[model samples]
Target: MDDRVAGALSLPEDWPAHPDLSLALNRMGSFDWDLDSGLMHLDRPALDVFDLRPEEYNDRPADLGQRVPEDEGARLDTMLVQALEAGQESYGAYFRCRLRDGSLRWTHTQGFIRRDADGRPRRILGIVRDASQELADSVARQELDEERRRRTSLVQATSAALAHARTVQDVIDVLKNSRGLAHLGAANIVMGLLEAGRIHLVAEGPEGSFVPGTRYTKVDERYPMSEVLRTLTPRFIETPDDFARSYPELWGQISHLGVTSAAYLPLIAQAHPIGALGLLYDDRAVFAGDERNLLVSLSSSIAQSLQRAMLYEQEHDLAEGLQQAMLPRRIPEVPGAQVAVRYRSARLGRDIGGDWYDVIPLPGGRVGAVIGDVQGHDTHAAAVMGQLRIVLRAYAAEGHSPATVMARASVFLQELDTDRFATCIYAEADLTTGVMQMVRAGHMEPLVRDPDGSCHKLFVEGGLPLGLSAEFGSLDYPVSTVELDPGHTLVFYTDGLVELPDTDLDGGMRLLTEMVRNGPQDIRRLADQLCESVDGYGGEDDVAVLLLRRDAVPSPQPGGRLRQHVAQNDPEALSSARHMIRAAVRAWGAGERADEIELTADELITNALLHTDGGAIVTIRILAGGERRLRVDVEDRSSALPRRRDAGDAGVSGRGLMLVDRLADVWGVESRGGGKCVWSEFLIPERFERPGRHEPPAHHELPDRRDRGGRDRGGRDRGGRGGAGRERPGGDGAPREP
Candidate 1:
């Protein structure tokens, strides 16, 4: 049998079959190859499937080839070539092949090669099936599923618009205008809450569109919207007639606003009806079920946002209370001063402004006055204000001068490392002297209102605000001093009282002047009047006030006026010390140690001139009352700290501290700012005469009175009587005994 023949022929060879294969010659839907002739044949159905005819297949052009997509066709051709050349058993694959009609179709081809007896391929045969429709349907189904996934993703993306909403208004705004929803409608959303019996507008969308008037009052008993809100049931109407039938009273208002339909959903926050949301439309058509579902979902988000907003309000209240407690409850009493104070917080929120004032008492019957503002408007500012106030009191109590007090406080503020800066005014006044001195650290100067209605502003120069200048050398604050007249009031306050937008600072000062001139006389009344008058000024920043009065002159005491006697130079100082030391020895009844005490006094005078910056002046006085002792005081400006020298110095280099410590009954150094002083005192002797200017009694001395000059000797006579008896142990290896 020929390899081109199958079991039977279903069609004639000349029939219009596909041109590439012999369908009529081979009726069976299979292909065969003749190993000897190298010719291939397919049955009728196989030829028809591939669109080839039996007559045309035999006379087909030698260059005619199956058309397939490049990658798949290349793979299939490689597999078939290997089977034909290498005598492989069979190969099969699905690939896209082009038909003679210029259309492409997918085919499944299974084929084998005929081999010669020497194991070499002589011909190849195959059969192909069209599977194009099945492959196209599978791909179409996968594309449809992918499109559905994309729609689901778009719906999930809408959730982000609601993420930033924490209030009913916020949610409504997001639903209407956020996430590109503004094109949905005119973006008009209204929020209402039930108060006192009716639904009152709490917030409205497209702001300023709905002008809430007297028609929207809460006490209205017959408003149709109020009834729907009170019932907690959702209501919908799509036309004027429908609206009248469902809510007769609201129909007129709705028609006036051109609203043809509306959906009302009750808002329940934390399980209670706080308000309701109404989605409105301008057309008469009713909304579908899915559109209503979206509105209902948005209502739930609004309810959650309302709950969070309520929580935030409660927390804000707590913070406000904490800020208020940090300030002083009331002004304090200063003996010779009048005080006043005021504080205000922001009206709309829990922002407590930082303004404070305090009047503190000090030793020596003085008072410290302060007014300051920390740079903020919250709990942190109030806290810093409290810390500054406490420190001010402590520093004032330590007997610091006005300038010193402010300078020290600036250093303290720099070390605190707070995030904000502060401006303060520190002043100290003595009740007894009627003298007022103040220092301003970048603060407004105080105003002085005299009894005669004259006003004056006290300004300080050359001081920086606290925390700005961190160096010690830059901390030199100047003090302003004035002799405040009797019945005058000094007013210290924060800038809030006078500063106003668009008004120059000088104008602010002038305004304060006018306020004082026309204000009340009582300090508390005046302070209240000024604050109330300036409430709208400067955006109502927090204000604080402090008032002070200089007291009347005090009565004088006895012995208040004593002549001061000062002696400088080494010789004059030593002579004064000896005279004073002799009087103390005689007065205290320590006659046995009179000579030693006098020698010690001489050493002290010489030490002051040698080691000190200059030869210091020494003063001597005798007290008739209050211990009745002689006194010697040395004043110097040296900054070095005093220490005791060892007693082993045979020479006279460092003998002052040692001798003074051993001889005086008590001794110590008192520290003043920038300097120190070493002071000591010895008990007076009873038998020793308080030395006169020139002489001492002859019976009290047993040695030569003159030192080879015929002048009175080391020990002078009480009555100038010559006692020229024996040579005394002098400075050149001489000793004298008392």
Candidate 2:
């Protein structure tokens, strides 16, 4: 070799090359690395392996390690040091090298360690081989494996989150907040469901991507979600241009959101497409086959879960509607008694169970409490429960005994042709006598708590459940009687109270007896505590409870009388009568019925003014007794009696008398020899009575001044006719009684 060539190659003149070694070195690139001097010499083949010119090669041996990738260079240095320390004759290393063009190439170096005279390492002579293609194939396989692992993890997390959702909104919340979707590179996630022929957006990620509940016509071809629903296929949009071309109408909106790529996958359940799932990305995204397949699989699970949640939500709403329509609006207020009722549906069922309770005010100031349960927990059972309740209420209102009401209701249920059986317990309490009569029909016995807080059950003899047999005439439900003394309580309930899953009838009854014995004194608070105590066990059946406590009777107030004066022929007395009646009823604490009483008084007063020469005298008497009565009387000098006339719908005048008859509990006409006094009595509801309110002074009794000709001797005309009657309003025609 010439001096310049040797200098460029960094080679010595005495370098030895055996034939076998020379042949091996010729095929692969050879290099000499100096251990102490830190100089390197490369052959022409070695220079070509690095893709470098001879002039570009640096003489420093450390420069070769710098040419390798940083990580590989560190590894190579470790391997060289270990080999030299072990005094090995040969050592090899494979490393990634950076070429002049800044590209990576996998290179393998095999060298022999040359030792000095003292057996210490001096230099290394090595051959370099390019392994770029082999390393590239290995790296591709590793990348594919990692991608698969990531996809699998995402799918598992998504399925788990969706599985726990119980409602449609819950599913929406999961999709919007799941970390798995974000990890999978989703910037915006939107879910649209087909509802009533329109695609409605149900859920969105990162807020503002799509408005929830925004609707689009399913038939519109420009909407991507609608298209997915129509075709039941997936769509992958690679760029904003693709979205603009496919769905021009929505492109403006999508572009404004900075969405560059999107994927719309149809969510199919039970071989039908119900909705679509959309994933959007701000940057360009390309989905590979594996990723696409993973998304499709995830969508299938999401669809089924979402469908279940939606169905549950629909059924839940329907069940609630049925319950609200059937249940009583408010419990009736019984005198000397505090009543409370509670109802709870089964926790683990799809159907709304047939549990019902009712408080009916029977005649003679008595209250009837009814509690029952149908055999099933379904919409049909609930309907039957409502119907059965109405029938029982009608029978009780007719003043039938508890046993007779049960027998009649049983026959009614059988005749209705409903394929369901019901267990019931009905009880009637006489508020005046503090006596209770109860009857059971295949139901649990009534629980009673005495004034001393001692509890016991009344094991009344009961017949078969309603609708169980056609022998209603033979079925005799025996009535059991118990005295509800002052501070005593009576409990009526269905089998759900003492038939828990974990406890038998005896055990449950004992537990209930304890709870009631130690319960709060307030009827409402006791009802709540009883329900919470028993219902904490996750009951399998619906529960219904009715609690009635007879409080100590209050002292009666003195009777109050209100009298309003009316001129013999004054038309303005009608308004004055209404005002007087309203004020009297309100002061008596019967304000809830004030409107009805005022109307009734106005009708009677107007009738007297229209038909009689002398105007009517309006008297309102508030009686304070066991059952309070509000009596309104109108006495006039007319002999004509008001008869009930069949009034047409459009005729307003004749309906006044009809309203008085319908609104008043009892009404009659009393003739005091001359004039007739028409009186109407209204039994005030117990809720209106103020317990400790003072009463007004009683009024003096007025003598009967009626004559046989229907003209009152005291109310005879004293020159108060027509114009004169209007001028002397407070004169002879004025009210005589204070």
Candidate 3:
């Protein structure tokens, strides 16, 4: 007998059992216990039954507790309490406990009590026995009972993987990592995909176990495992010797790979075998019945995981690629501005993020910029982002204000079929006026970094995200303005970069401020730095940033600035006629064009001021083409036309129009808005001769001066003859002198 077992069988020195009682106790494996104090006095038979020593039971519950199952600790404590209270004359328990060798055995324990006349328990007796072997048999049966359940789950998972996997390669990958469905040997695992009817080896596990990229022909293959897949049943190759005996020609190939046994399970999809799972074993161990059952069960699960990932990947690629292509190829140059941007996803899943930015040129020398984030991370989100981008650009091009654009955009986005929401900031800046207009949806306030390196947020009140309010209120989003001083920077971004998990909004804003503070000055450099920093801060969503710097103003010099002429309505071939004024400016020189153009424009206005009624307003614009040339336009609000009299008979007033017609390169007039405007231009003298320079004759200095007075005089006679041309202020009289 083992010495430990013998010692445990020994009796205590003081309460040694008598020969007769020892025989009885050994036969019955009986013991006595005082539950209140947790004392156990076990007979040698009972102690030996649990492989415990006599001294271990001396007021010690540890010995019995050692046998209690970890999961049953609470139940056993309650049982002990009931026994101590004498609630029942007898009690019983059954549980697993550890033995002397650290092996566990299930024991069935029963106790009986001897009570006094008052029915109070005085003494308790118990019996214990080793039930380890019996319990093992019970567990084995229970495992068998659960086999059907596990198989069902595995099949369902595999079916799902198969249904979702779109590509052949993805199908194989899905099967590879499908866990818990089979007792697959993690070692020597390889996957072969069927592409274009050819078996191409796609993946293998246990690095270097099999030559990668190896291909094998499916035709004329004597693979019982592969053959069995056609029937959708698990195929088994019990042993290499058996395979050799059954198919000698193919035995050498299997033996060379040290294949001693194998099983091929069919990966079925929609009642068809899309592929076969070939599991190879290099040892001679026969496939255990349970393991084969487990493998078959798990095959379906592996198939399903593969299917899901593949489908997701396909949609992700298409949606994400299209979204990126729709984005601007590069930031445009706003000569005086700096720009930066960053984008990322909050989740690991496919196409879940839809964030975008755009810079557009607006009328009246302004630039429009927008940054918006879509609410989801899938193809739908990306699609919506693309749509919104297109709509915003078109609306801006149509000359809508930032606030109007956002207001209309919300309606457009809400009408989309997809369930996507967005937050955005729309801003426009008039470079000529230094005026900036901005409207924000429910988005993080943009950061403004002044030239002094001080950063502040552009927080506007009364804004909400798009797609939330059914009847989007007039994008009452406050439009804020700030002077975009030269060298100062404005940054717009999606909230993703600043939003940390569970952090307060203010804290996130502060962190973003710090990031911008530490960022580089150059737009591109700042963009890259912000991306890296936000990622480091554990940014959970896609981060997008757009930075703008107002460029320094260009110095004013000849040919550097645009020039314009303003004029007014006319009568009798109005001296400030629109066409004539435009033609004159076109012929005039670019240098000092501003002064010359303004004077010519003022003369036309003075004539109209002296002639027309109802407050005539006229404007002329000189569209400069180059350093020496320009095009001109003039407009006025008078319907009554201008008149011209003979230059020889003209007075100071008539001389003004004749002098203008003679000096300007060209002059004319046409009806405008609700009236007519006449205009003319005078060339700026290039070089004025000194007082005693002995200048050339007037006729030689200026070629005939166009002789246009005769044409105007004739036009006045014709207007007087008919009623076609409206009369001037002094139409019936001769010319007025200034």
Candidate 4:
């Protein structure tokens, strides 16, 4: 109520609220330092600036050390010295000064130098003020700028990551796992895609906080996600009570999660809401000012990515359907063998591949298993695979030999109008005799698992891939034969099953071998387990697996036969034939005559290789009559007739006829086209004849050596040499002189 006396300008009682009184309200003070006396004089406000009481003050600047930190005081002295030396009229600085409670307060000072003629001879006058509020405002501005930069960085990182998302799951993975989303300050993320008039919740927040029936709700429903979608607007939630009041359905279920705030954004692409995105925060208030705009922009980006991913999935599904149709519809039940087949599509990208498998039943209880992959991963590769599979199956079913089938398939693929090539492995197995001949075309080696659960790689010499071999004129695929023992499993697969990123084929093969060894004993279960392992790896390539397990079959009796191709001068081939004879004679129930059968077969094989032009095929079989008999036949390309030869103890060669005649019960020679067969037979012991199988038809013909057709080509038999076990191959013909 007081009024000022006459200068006649009257101010209200609250004078500090006036704009002109701002300078006084700033808490400013002044001081005078007399350099000559090294003493300072301060006003009442100046003592207050230093937080010093009147009784604690002296007329000296050094006494202010109790108020100003030592470092800050030195800084002020340095500023003064520089001002005086530079002949400056003014100087200023801001520093921290201590208060009576021993806490720091920001202070500012500006000084004017009064100098004499020499400039060094001077006194200083300065002002000091409390600057805590002013500087605190500046610090606040810096913090806001930092937050802005972080948001900008997050947006850029999220956009870059979403650029590579080619599938819907990929987009979800980025949102849940990417570093950008992790730094968004969101505790968890939720997402829902709109399909068929409903919101399908694809991603949920936290462990299990998803509301019960709210997962798939209609657009008109009273839920936050539904509200955002229905209005095509962004919903920014401020606090826990605000959330609970607005959307009690969602809040009740999620309140236990400590979610105080949230943002539900309408994911709109092309003016339509395709999905909704929800960001959950715990114990925080979110989406103020530009933050709401940031969420909207983020939702837009997510919408575009989701749309693109869905489109990719649609196109990929169509291509993958074509791939499945091209693969074998179903593996046929094969006699004498159990078959399991599987094909998995590529998971990383939208492209479909040409990995495939097939099971073909051949005539005469034989079966063919095939595994192959075309060159590229696309619709074109799948098309080529379909055509190639058809042609390969046709050729195999045409009674072609394993090598012939592969060679013809290679030629056929090259002749096709496409530029694709395929790597493949084909196996032709005669279950009756436990003999399988394999042909490889630049494919991965097959793995054979024994009955005891140990596995090893079976390396067959191979030519170039189908199309490439024909182009390069190297179409001679080697036919490597393996005798499948009862309960042994032959594993055929494409490279995709073993190949992994950054790993070599050798390492991959080792891992695959271990997996096969440890897999379940049942072939079907094992096949599923193998595909499951590949699935868990998230492999980039498509895979196909074919397992043919020979069921436990009785030993070969009258129809039992083993065939092999022995190249000229191939010592290894001669030795393998001998070992087979020994194991076969023992397994055929000839206990005392195993050695005689093996030795006689060795002499005939040695004679054929030593005298033939190229190589010979050896066939050993059990012939049923009044007595069980084991015979050996060596058929070479050459038809030269073989006769008895003499060799004394000193002679290193010959004596083949003497060995054959002495060991065999009956020995003879028969002439056939392109070859002559020298044969001998030995009477197997009575106990060796098997029940229900000892009698074969009178015209029962053995499969030919090369084409493997049922034919009675003249057979040359070798009598017993000391050998043992039912065992397992050859061309039939006469013995030749060495």
Q: Tell me the lDDT of model 4 at 278.
A: 89
How should the candidates be ordered by lDDT, best one leading? 4, 2, 3, 1
What is the C-alpha local distance difference test score of candidate 3? Answer: 0.61
Off by over 4 Å in 3: 1-185, 188-203, 214-264, 274-284, 329-355, 361-366, 373-388, 394-423, 429-437, 449-456, 460-479, 483-489, 495-738
Model 2 alpha-carbon miss at residue 324, Å: 5.9
Cα lDDT tens digits for candidate 2, 88-183: 999887787888888888888899999989999888888887777667888899988886887787788888999888777888778768887776
Backbone steric clashes in candidate 4, count: 40
The candidate with the higher TM-score, 3 or 4, is 4
Query: Per-model C-alpha lDDT, please?
Result: 0.60, 0.73, 0.61, 0.78
The most accurate candidate by lDDT is: 4
Cα RMSD (Å) per model?
Answer: 20.7, 19.8, 13.4, 8.8
TM-score of 3: 0.50
TM-score per candidate, in order?
0.41, 0.47, 0.50, 0.75
What C-alpha lDDT, on a 0 to 100 scale, does residue 273 get in candidate 2?
79
lDDT of 2 at 307: 92
Better of 1 and 3 by lDDT: 3
Candidate 2 vs candidate 3, TM-score winner: 3
With candidate 3 superimposed using the best TM-score fit, by how many Å does residue 293's alpha carbon deviate from the native? Answer: 1.5
Q: How many residue pairs in model 3 have overlapping backbones?
A: 51
